[model samples]
Target chain A: MAGYAVELRAVWKRFLGPAGETVAAVKELSLQIADGEFFALLGPSGCGKTTTLRMVAGFELPSDGEVLIQGKPMGKTPPYQRPVNTVFQNYALFPHMTIGENVAFGLQMQKVGRQEVQRRVGDALEMVRLSGLERRRPKQLSGGQQQRVALARALVNRPQVLLLDEPLGALDLKLRKEMQLELKKLQREVGITFVFVTHDQEEALTMSDRIAVMDAGVALQVGSATQIYEQPNCRFVADFIGETNFLEGSVQQLQGGQALVELPGGLSVWASMAQPVAVGNPVTVAVRPEKLTLRPLEAPLANQLQGQVVDQVYIGTDTYYSVRLASGQTIRVREQNNLAALRQGAQPGDTVCVQFVAETASVLTG
Target chain B: MSQPRQSPWLAALSGLVYFFLYAPIVVLIVFSFNVSRTNVVFEGVVNQGPCGPFYWYCELLQNRSVADAARNTLIIAVTSTAVSTLIGTLAALALQRYEFFGKKSAETALYFPMVTPEIVMGIGILVLFSALFGWVNSMLPPGLRLTLGLGTVIVSHIAFSIPFVTLVVRARLHGFDSRLEEAAMDLGAPPLTTFLRITLPLIAPGVLAGAMLAFTLSLDDFIITFFTTGPGATTLPIYVYGLLRRVVTPEVNALSTLWILVVLTVVGLSQWFQQRE
Candidate 1:
């Protein structure tokens, strides 16, 4: 087996819509998922993440480029011939078969002996915590149980990779969180590559070892959750991952790794440059809401702004204050509800100072 | 639970509708046991009650022509139902799963036999078979002969019955999720294995219902059978028609009562199976 379990080399997919117009679903997308890695493709609907997963599973053939499984090119291979299994969005458990039969389907297809099939099916069901209910039909089980059965069915095959397309999308938020941890644990125990696709950012962040953030049929960035969140490479990546305050400005000077950006109202701020930016070039400095600290206007800080608190929202865990700067730009600041006495001191129309460090803000060129 | 009170007019209307529907059937059942040979009048003198309960039933059981006609009807019904169900299920699968040129036209052709008047369909089949047999006979040797008989009647029954089977099975296919098949293939089952194990069992009820309908239709057909049959291919409906041409007899009523029971049993069985699923 190769170091990489699955690889897509510059894959492209095109479809003709119902109106006879061509649509590019996935455009020159290249990704390599390593063995025993939990990789996530995170994107919203119409971003072609699902199409990429389908190509690797052999459900779709790429219009251009090649798909390789374990370093062997998959050319015109049917889904049944591929060494992979998928947990569909709807769970897709066989309505006519019992849970046991559904789990044993892959083994029976390989002409395994009856005793071995029975033992493996039992063990798989037990692994999913559905051992006693094997004889029950899919309709008789709850949605979460049905999802477990789908997972067991796919995992029992012990394929080189497992593809999950939004498997937790149908569940409620509480159950989705529970299954997120469960799925990660199972992936580690099985030691097989899991290629998961989801539109939920939190799910991708919490579960994936690495994430490929996609938009408009293109992968914008691929990195760890902390890397993608803290040090976004572009304006879109910074905006999409979490809430951020963007201050548009022109670069005044570049010294070492820091660029000085001059905002409106003659306010100069230093930000760490993600890419090289020449002097006088347009740039945007992005600072996370949580990284900004609110202090009294008289306090002196390295990177400080004088702003008035225009609006305040009190959520249970955190309070958000929308501060309007002297240049008429509004930026949000999130404060944890650690001290109840501190929240009563800040109110709308009150002048406040926002303090942040130069390393906390990232400079984006485009 | 408290029962809702029925209005007087609604109660009367419901009773009248029931009477209108079942009065002829009741009369038929009652007269099947009449002692008189004639169907129109009771045997007892004026204002007398029915004379014997088992008289015509016994007569019908001993009739050789009735037995032969029953055998022919059973053969045609069973054969046509089996053949049409297989063909119609394949047609339904094709229509549901694939797209091709002239698909709409083909679907419309399937419904043509169902909507056309029975007399028109019977005449069309008669003309078509006669012309086809004429051509074949002209090409054959002199001693061998070809004629319209049981084979023609069975074929005509199958032609009309297929549309009904297709309609029922297609309705079942509408509720089916195509992802189940994809999931099967994802788990390493080939296309044929997936269909046999997953697709077939899910749609079995619809196929059975279609077969039952086809069998009942073939069993009771009169116009098409009358036109397509020859000397040795008289089915039950045609035999009853022949008996009616001379005079109405208690034997005819007895035979009709038994046929009603068979049809009811088949329909009831189909409904039971469908409800069970």
Candidate 2:
């Protein structure tokens, strides 16, 4: 197995829109997917994640630059010649073929021996936990079952890389969660590089070893799930990956890789600078909701903001408090419901202090 | 709430519509078994009990001209259907997959024959073929002159049937999920293998339906065949028309009934195939 299972070298894809305008679906983008890694391309619709995957699978040739699979440049190579298989978003199983036939299609196309094809198909189906109902047509199975068949069909070939294009986008939330875990387990067991594309941030966070957050045909940031969540690099990444409270301010001073930012209401807080910013430059500080702790008014914390609790949303596992700060900005604070006895933390209209460790906040430019 | 009952007037109106649609077919079927040779009136019922269920059918079968015409009809229908299906399916695939200049115009041209008046289309084809044969004969040797015949009729049938087949197959392609072919190709199946193993089977029902429709249209064609056919190329419909012009015989009714049966069988089989999907 190669170190980099797939590498997209400054790839660019352009499409002609319906109005005859040139639309860049993917700009000059470069990415390297390591072998046996569960990498996710996370973005909203039309962010070119699917297009990038298709180019890797040899379905679409890049308008510029090159796509290399296993360190070989793929120029004009058709999809059939590529050593990769795709699980389509719609689970495009052959409706005319039975489940077993669908799973065996790739092997049959490769002209594998009959016994080997049978054994592999059986094993693939068993891997997806669909062992008994092989003779049934694709339409006879439920959506989740059909999705599993699609996975089995592609995995039976044992391609070097598995490309999944939002394979769980159609399922309900509960089923999607189940399949997310199932897919992660399957990827680990198979030890094949899986490039998954999805718009669901939570799904990507839960299932991916690394994620590339993309927007408007550009990869905004690439990092591990925790790195992306806890340490987003830009304003868009900070906002897109999860909920975060932003405080627009100017840098007061820079010292020891940390900068003091002055907020709107004469409040000063320190934020770790991932990128160097000079003093007195405009910056945006981002802090996650869960990172902020609700404390009583007189508590002496290193970084604290006085706010009035205006709203409380009681979800099953956690309670979200909406606090109106003195700067006229509303910030959200999430508290886990850990107490056995029902004890209200802060009622609406009560004054509270929102505190956070200074180093937990990130300073972003632009 | 109580369910509303069907209005008596609406039910009667629907019944009238069905009667209007099926009355002629029912009358034709009833008269096909008439005992008398003349079917202009109920003269056979006054003297004889009724026409035999098989007498005219046997008589028509024994007639050499009718037999020849039936054979020619079958030949023309089968050959034209096969040719049209192949060409139309290829055309449909091209239309579905590719974009080129004048593609919209080509799609519109495909639908022209379907909506044009049959008489106008027949006359147009007749004129076109006459001019074509005239030019061909001018170039040929002096002794041999091209004229309209069975081959000409088959060609004309294929020309009109291609559009219908294309329309049917295109409808099927509309519902098809294109990702299935991509998946096949991704799984190491070459383009030809992907088409044959995946696309062809998935679209087989549409192709079969289109072929069956073309076959029935070619078998029962009258106006176009009448204008395009020569003496030796008389199909079953033209033969029956000629028989009607000479004398309205019970044999013509028997032939009509048999034609209806063949058409019904073909259409029913096509429906069965389509519904299986």
Candidate 3:
């Protein structure tokens, strides 16, 4: 990665209320994005991600600390002087201007030569695959088209960092998926750092090289997608990133990286690691559904736990089973639709045994 | 398709309202060419009496005082509209897009001029300028009496029109997204340039609509203009008022007809502009 394109050091922002009360929107946020890196601020709404982005954009000023762009302190430097462009969630295209005019707006402001402005505008539009839509007003375009126009307008200036605040949020499900791929490709082609903000976990995982999962103005974890998904640092990150079946228990045994946990009904299970917990300390064991294996009622397997099949669902690619374990706890297991149509005729009352490797699940200490 | 039809009483009530509103306008247009000066009775002969339609219409057009009044009215309307629209549009943009102390109170203050009675506003402005400034008697030439003539009338019109302009433009600005300005700014346009190149063009239609409304308000204004205006600044409405009390003439009907036509033209143009949005 190149030198940091944008950097924030312990930035804080406070909003004053009508009654002179102060509310901190962004609390001591410190982050850095290298050149050409796509970083995502992933969080639920009002988690200070947008505030952080706004602070970087100079739409807001930090109450404390510093914002740096290309190694310069950007204190009170207006957005126009900042070497960054923002793709707003609503795709805020100039309603009065045509697509071409909107793209040429920045160039015109800098007093760029008219010929150069037109040429650059054409090139930018072509980059976004909107070459022929020059004369169309923003309202005349579809939502996706307007988004592209917005992208082209920002990208025309070739900003060092592109800040996108849920740019694909206004799109429908299928369109959002398509735009995600398009954005990734655009980011690569442009080779500029992208600071994207989103509440959607899947979007962050799909698009970001590094994800900062935030909650309540605090960043819980910042890591690669695999690190975030497989080895979440906290309970919030574990629950937020993906679905995890949590089994609360005290650590019965802790040897090296593996641990055995005793269940409530005299059952014991082995897990990969007991997240730095001492023996008899409370912990929640998290396991992915696909990690477990299901066998016939009497089939022998390592770490056997007997259960009855409460529900079976065929999802074309995989068949899912909701098994009621011996301890009255229900756990889900997904099986790939292999050659054998296993458990097709298994009724809700039929008994089954669930098995999985010790390393497939991890024990999260609380 | 399954809903019951509207009652006849409701339809009759609506028709009565339509008649009540337009019947006077119809009477004015018809009596503009009334053979007799008094519209209550029409002589059998048309254009044969001393109060002929052609003669009165000619008199109304040829009268220098009426012409001067029309010119003054147009001048005041256009000037005040221009001034107020500029100020009001900027105010709207500032109040809508920024966060500052007492913004809510500032907005309320903008609308305060609109709520205050025109007579009250006029009298208050006059008293403030004359008493507070003291330049009223000491600075100005004789016979001025601190009355600003055309200037005072335009200023009063602008004062009344500003609130309306701010109101209309503010409504448009409220629905406007601030992200566009951010986008422009992000792309390297300075704040003022962004406002000029992006914000102003987008909000221009609203400003225009408000200005047109202001012009109409200024043109039809009588009480405030009458209170503020000196002898030389007799606008059309004041002239019409004077004619109503002074003498019987068909020229008022001609002048009234012209005024209605101009109003209709402005209203139609404004509607056309508003619909483009």
Candidate 4:
């Protein structure tokens, strides 16, 4: 690897609140995006994901700290001076100009030659699968087509890094899914680093090679999708990424990197320590619904517990069971609706043994 | 698509209101063709005059003072519209985009001219100009002394027209998506280039509407023009007012008809341009 395509060194962005107090939108967050990597800043609203994206785009400067693009320290460089492009959420296509002009805008702004602009604009449009609609204005295009035009407009510049601020937020669910795959494919084809900000966890998981999950102006965790979902470092990251069953427990013993935690009702389960924990300290064991197997064991087993199925929902591919443990803690289990599983499907009031994929389950301290 | 059902009485009332508004102007236009110099009675179209059916229009063209007034009106209207539109658009942009000291006060003050009586503002401008001229004239030589003329009238017209232009342009700027500007900047256009390539084109309709409004106001202004105008700087309105003091001739009617036709054509052209965009 040559260097990071983009880096934020302890960036902080503070804004004046409506009541005249300083509000830190982004608080001392640092990240390094790899070259040609598809990275996502995933968070709920008010979590400073958009602010971080804007800071990278140079539209909003950091109140403190540094943003480096391609190993160059960009200290107070205006957005125009930055070698980056942005795809705004609304697509922000120029309504007054034709699609040809909109796509050619960045090239013309850089004072590219007339013939070069025309050829590159045509190529960029074709790259986004919008070759024949150059003469049409923005209003004349459909929503998905406008989104493609927006992509072409940015991709035409061929910047080192492309910043997208919730680019697919406005699309319908079906279109969003299609565009998500198309964008990933296009990013791979172009081989430019992408740093996209979004609130949708599935979109991040489905597209990004690495994801930084943020909450309340702080990046809680940053890792790959499997690492983030299978091994969350914190309770917030675990809950934010996907539905996780948390059982309150105290550490009984530590072995290798795993922990033996004793739950209420004298039940014990073995869980992986994503973050180190002290023996006799209270922690929460997080296990995903799909990771838990609901089967009746011969007797009792390590990483196994007893529960009665209080609710079961058949959702075509999988059956979701809400099982209540003897300690009265509710845990949801998702099992595939195979023929054998369906034949022995447990309904409400049926006692079943819930097995944990202990190697993948996380014990979070906070 | 289903439209709301219209009431016949409401339609009749609206028609009556339109007639009430346009009847006098229509009468003024029709009377312009009268052959009689006294426009009190509707004389038949002049088939015997040198210009055939356009007798009064010919007379209106022959009036040298009226020609001077028309020329002065055009100069003042065109100059003030151009300058006011430029300055007012900048003012609107600053108000909409930037935050500075006294911004709240400035926002409130922008609508003062729109709300204040034109006659009151005219007198205030007249007094202010007189005071300024009085101060400067005392220091300058008599041969090169400044006086109230087209300059003062244009200045006053620009002052009053700014609030209107700013209001219209500011309203347009409110709907503008600032992300377009950022997108341009990210594409390597500096702030100025982004404004020129993106911001200006989008808000152009609002700027044109404001300019048109300023132009019409300058063309038809009487009170403000009256207070600031001097000898040889009389506008068409002032000239028409002067003529009404002694005689009510068909020349005035012909001038009014021509003015109405030009304003209509300009408005129609602007509407067409907006639709074309």
* Best candidate (score: TM-score): 4
Q: List the residue pairs that clash in candidate 1.
A: none
lDDT of 2 by residue, A1-366 (tens): 554899988999999999999999999999999989999999999899999999998889999999988888889999998989999999999888999999999999889999999999999999999999899999999999999999999999999999999999999989999999999999999999999999999999999999999999899899999999988999999999889999899999998888999889888888888677999999999999989988778964557899999999989888899999998999999888777313748889999998888788999998
Q: Residue A362 of model 3: what lDDT?
A: 79
After superposition, the stretches of candidate 3 with alpha carbons farther than 4 Å from their true spots are A16-22, A296-304, A340-347, B1-13, B35-40, B44-54, B94-148
CAPRI quality band, candidate 2: high
Q: What is the C-alpha RMSD of each candidate to the true structure, in Å?
A: 2.9, 2.5, 3.3, 2.1
- Cα lDDT tens digits, model 4, A1-366, are 546999999999999999999999999999999999999999999999999999998888999999999989999999988989999999988888999999998999889999999999999988998999999999998899999999999999998999998999999999999999999999999999999999999999999999999998899999999999988999999999899999999999999999999999988889999897999999999999999889964599888989899999999999999999889889999999999999999989989999976796899995
lDDT of 1 by residue, A1-366 (tens): 664798888989999888989899999998888989999999889899999988988889999998998888998899999999999999999988999999999999989999999999999999999999989999999889999999999999999999999999999999999999999999999999999999999999999999999988889888999988998888888988889999999999898899999988888899999878999999999999999988877955568999999998989788899999999999999988887636555789999998888999999987
Model 3 chain B: ten consecutive residues of lowest lDDT: B42-51
Docking class of 3: medium
Chain A: TM-score in each model: 0.96, 0.96, 0.92, 0.98
lDDT of each: 0.91, 0.91, 0.84, 0.91
For model 4, residues B1-277, the per-residue Cα lDDT tens digits are 8999999999999999999999999899888887777878887876656787788888889999999999999999999999999999999999999989999999889888888998999899989999999999999999989899999999999998998899888878888999888888888888889899899989999899889888988999999999999999999999999999998888889899999988887777656644544
Candidate 4 residues lying further than 4 Å off, grouped into runs, are B1-16, B270-277
Candidate 3 chain A — worst ten consecutive residues by lDDT sum? A339-348
Better of 2 and 4 by TM-score: 4
What is the alpha-carbon RMSD of candidate 4 to the true structure? 2.1
TM-score versus the correct structure, for each prediction: 0.94, 0.95, 0.90, 0.96
